[model samples]
Target: MAALDEIQTIVILMQENRSFDHMLGHLSLEGLLPDVDGLRQEDMELTTYANEYRNRFYWPFLIQDEASVIRDPPHSRHLVQVQMARSSSGKKFRMSGFVDSYIQYTQHQTEHPPPMGYFDSRGAWMTSFLARQYCVCDRWFTPLPSDTQPNRCMAFTGTTLIDDTDSRLIPHREHVFDWLNARGVRWRVYHDGPPFFLLFGRFHELVGMKYRPFSELAHDIQHEDPGQAPQVIFLEPRYFDFFWSDEPANCNHPLALVCHGERLLHRVYTALTCNPEKWARTLFIHTYDEHGGFFDHVPPLPIENPPPPGADFTEGFKTTGPRVPGLLVSPWVQPGKAFHGNLDHTSMLQLLAEKFGSGPEDYSASVNHRRAQRIRSLSEALADAPALRPIPTRAPEPCPPMPSMKRQPRAPNERAFQKAALELLQHEGPIATAAKYPDLVGAPLTP
Candidate 1:
């Protein structure tokens, strides 16, 4: 393993749904990265990756106005099963069912489903710029073939108790935070609103110093003591459930303006680079939790293991979910290359083990199973020494305004988060929970 000790801190900013093909596929379509496994012209011309619905086949088309709000695609467990179109071979897939799956959710609005759309470099300016200037992992798949919660569960815990975004306190073994804590690895969360961890428990530290607002990240990056700095920092964007808040959701969830996520990326990157010496010692990872029902050409590698007994999901997944865009930014990585080694969300855990634990298997037994399956870690993306002497920082992306919502929780994930907060209220008492997560608990939730 590379001496990752030189990389003093690892920062992860996991944005919401949106796939590799939908977000950074333009890198391939525009011929900017000839070798990238993104969208292709022939796939469109020959209709190789087209999906048929309502007696019409929908091919990937460029979204001319990505700044405008679009509809969310279907991404539930059963819906993703339909979307994958698992072939008789079981290992391979037709990979052409996104449109059919989307219309399954929104039956009446069948004209031009969002899953069949692609964004140009200008549309996903921040992501495209980063991929071009850093390392883009084109083969990074969501660990689970389901909705946001389970996939995120796999990302953080290396396993899942639920397959769908069903509302409840997510029961588990050891979460990533617990694992880090047990090993004495300092970690922190910086969030724009209520941190997503509120969905898990009502621990005192979770509501205290362990979580801070994104507004404080710049100051911390510039001024925090190097030895006392957190080894792992998680950045949480404003989620869709906070639509009633003063700020618009910038997580790139469907129906959200894409530029908002770009602005958040710009904000975080600029802050990290403000101190070049600190930036050189930091590795920033920007990826999404799942595909959010967007179409991607790459089928997930075959899923082989079944969840342990008593998992909320008993039916074993046949494959990982679709490929999501993953970017690696640091002075240790060379720019302008696509790292094609197969990776899943657990790969990050493998990296943590290699860095701080005994070995790759030190993450968890579940994560070791993936390591046995050749799931590569983020460690491979780093060099033994810093490759880029003077790291390049891209120009700030000009973010436009997105239409705000002051309505009830309409999205499934939004309602799920609301439900988790409700559980927290029952466990921690109304006054305490509400004080901890004012906006999240103050807003009325539906049963």
Candidate 2:
């Protein structure tokens, strides 16, 4: 409780589409984070962790050169189900369908598979460094075994109406921003390009003040009156859709150079540490939206929660999605800690309620229900023990130049982002939007 009060600011940076085993599994395999529930030597050498496709068995292999040549893996609801391929007993997943699912969806029977590839410490330098230096929530999972839209909706709105990505504004009973505003919580969003929240209604009005570009984050952290600074801030990376005409995909979505997201992590950390007093009181969290169809040996936990009243998926979510990487950064956090608590995205809202509202249940009854079912708050990541006083700050090697494509691709999520950018431009007028978010200038207006 004291840790929550001493910390005056909480910043969240949620990247896209990478999974726990694919990104950080190698951490344990390489002896860096030996305690983490990551890849093991046996998993790589034996058939126990192998996935069978056709007559061939595949094990996790090192993805070298930052894996720029790797293609996006299929992560839709049905495909994810295929990837799980639960054992006959229905109590566990064989996790053997990943290679098959990839070949089936992409029709790349002869091509090198991407889902079984994993990155080592040097490959995922930024994430590994933070994990080694602070606390890593090893058991955190995405709320559903699906793709971006539904999991993200679960993160921000406590519930989702759809189970897959669609090219439209996400319908939510209430947005987190509305909840924050009603309770008078000061919050802000900083984006490298177009803010992801534009997918929700009222994005235009929010863009100018509540939603600002990445450029202003450092300034606000260093120069703004300490009391006037936002209590919470969300940092949105350059999504994959923006890189066709803009910068590299910094959110680490499939097909993106993972280094871009690493570089983004460096930038946000640097900005926060640039202000020592603020840094002392700030808590920065880093996590991914979903697994992006990567291979994970762990099966989803069975925690049944009925879907929203009008959800497209009539049946509620039966289990949590595959694990995603989660990091907790704060001066109050014990260094070299690995928290194994069972947590999900809704835990963030519960943390907020503990800090600002009545108690654990103040976030919402839905979130409180999940709490009753054993979902924990971020507060657990904060330590009451002595902490690292002088926060280490060393910049990492620059990422390689992003690979180029001949033309824009036709991913549905990309089109949805394009639509959101267009709606923002239409609502605020190009001139005003340009002044507010210069990065959205060339955002595609059509699918």
Model 2, residue 105: C-alpha shift (Å): 0.5
Please give, for residues 48-87, the per-residue lDDT of candidate 1 as tens digits: 7889886788888889876443777888888988888887
How high is the CA lDDT of each candidate model?
0.82, 0.83
The candidate maximizing TM-score is 2
Each candidate's TM vs. the true structure? 0.94, 0.96
Clashing pairs for model 1 are none
**Could you give candidate 2's per-residue lDDT for residues 156-232 as a string of tens digits?**
98888888898777777787777888899899889887767877767556556778778789989999997788998
Q: Which window of 10 residues has the lowest lDDT sum in candidate 2? A: 400-409
